[model samples]
Target: DETALGTLHSNRSAAYFAIADYANAIQDADECIRLRPKWAKGYFRKAAALVQQQRLKEGVTAYERGLVFEPTNAAMKAARDDTILLQKVKYVPYPTSVMAPAKE
Candidate 1:
């Protein structure tokens, strides 16, 4: 029954994420994790919601935690890699050419 409840919460979290409701998604994902600590799906949901909210560090941490339980999950690996890329891009400065005004 607890696993079933966890699944329900996980489903709700995904639905919230689909609607761009990162807050609710994260909340439900947390509930799922609480209900099923070893389940990777909950971590995936939480990571995704955190990423959507621009909480990159936390997202990456969540992904790492999930990977500890499901190291063979290709999807989670890809998502984690993408999030790392996003973090890099976020901190990269624009090229001078892009920031400069064009020739008159």
Candidate 2:
């Protein structure tokens, strides 16, 4: 039951992240992690939110923490590596929205 709830929250966090709502994503992800501390997806969601918020250092920390819980997780490892590379390269994150002229 807890796992299912955690997964549901994780999914919601991902949706929030997709919509560029990093704050809410982080909040939902935190609740997900609290619901199921051992579930790696929560940490991944949290890390993704932090990264999207431009909190690169914090994101890397969260990702690494998730790796400790799931050393064999390829997705987590890949995301961590990508985040690290982006940090190293000083990657400029793109704006979450694109604006166009309003139609009359």
Candidate 3:
């Protein structure tokens, strides 16, 4: 049963993520996505691992792809929005005062 196998891969991906093993998580997520192309969970797992790796753009792309299959997924939508914000923040410069040494 391909679907069951896909579920198992997705579960493994989640386990890898829990252990902070992002590369393996992504690998398992990719397998799950290959086995179940229409399943949003695989994409979600991939996106999460990518985000943890600081690959924000790739994470956003994965989330967008998942949204195509489940447009009304609120959790995915929130995560995607948060990632977009994080990406924007990454390029923003901190205020000079924020980086200044404190006075004694």
Candidate 4:
């Protein structure tokens, strides 16, 4: 099934993460990690997928693992903090009209 896996697959997984398909993205990230365990981005991507899935606890754990290898990654730290805060706040979606988009 190696051929079933490709950069396109990884890219699609990232796209899924962008669109909030967390579970499916995690599946792709799973294969990516299996194929490239030493690759830091793979774990980082998985952490993002986990966060999107609302697996915040495990996502923070994953972020910690990634930090062990990518200590200088600022984005990772910000995301980790964001994940942790999700547990602290009880957010309710507000109406878009209340906060309109910024002017271009």
Candidate 5:
């Protein structure tokens, strides 16, 4: 029952964050975390809320914490990389060696 309630709250919090409702998102994320401390997605939800509220620094930090919890999550990896890139560039980007073979 408690776990189910936590999931509902956490999912709704993610929805709220998606629509820029940081306060409510944070509220629900907080509840979710309180209810399920091992849930990685809950932290990610909280990070999204912090991001939407214009607290970029703390938001990325929270995302990093999420990575600690979900190290192999591809979406989180991309988001983390993109956030770092966003901090560095609007137009210019550091060069990266392409992984695939270059065909003429």
Candidate 6:
């Protein structure tokens, strides 16, 4: 039951991340991790949210922590590697918020 709830939260976090709503994505991913610490997916979601929010080091740490719990999770391992590779490249984050015209 707890895992199921955590999965729901993780799924919602992914959706929020897809929309560039990194703040809410982090919140939902945090809850998922709290609900299911043993689930690799929860950690993956949290790490993804953290990376999107420009906290790359923290996100990689989260991935490492998750890997400790599931050493053989291929998807998680791939995600971790991808995150590292992305960090190595010069990343220019896209603006997620619209800007208003400057006041005269």
Q: Tell me the tens digit of each residue's lDDT in model 5 across 1-104.
A: 87998899999998887787899998998899788777778878887787667666666786787788789988877776776666556446545656556889
- lDDT tens readout by residue for model 4, 1-104: 65346455667779888888888888887777677665556678888999877788888888888788788889989999998899667465777987898789
Which ten residues in a row are the worst by lDDT in model 6? Answer: 93-102
User: Which candidate leads the pack in TM-score?
Assistant: 1
Per-residue CA lDDT of model 2 for 1-104, tens digit only, reads: 99899999999999999999999999999999999998888999999999988899999999998888899999999999999998978876555554555569
Estimate TM-scores for all models: 0.92, 0.82, 0.91, 0.70, 0.72, 0.75
Q: Is 2 or 3 the stronger prediction by lDDT?
A: 3
Candidate 1's C-alpha runs over 4 A off are: none
RMSD to the hidden true structure, all candidates: 1.2, 8.5, 1.9, 8.2, 8.5, 8.3
Judged by lDDT against the true structure, how good is candidate 4? 0.78
Off by over 4 Å in 5: 89-104
Cα RMSD, model 2: 8.5
Overall lDDT per candidate, in order of appearance: 0.98, 0.91, 0.99, 0.78, 0.79, 0.86
Candidate 4, superposed: residue stretches over 4 Å from native: 1-9, 90-104
Ranking 4 against 6 by TM-score, winner: 6
Model 3 CA lDDT for position 14: 100
lDDT of 3 by residue, 1-104 (tens): 99999999999999999999999999999999999999999999999999999999999999999999999999999999999999999989999999999999
Query: Which candidate model has the greater TM-score, 5 or 6?
Result: 6
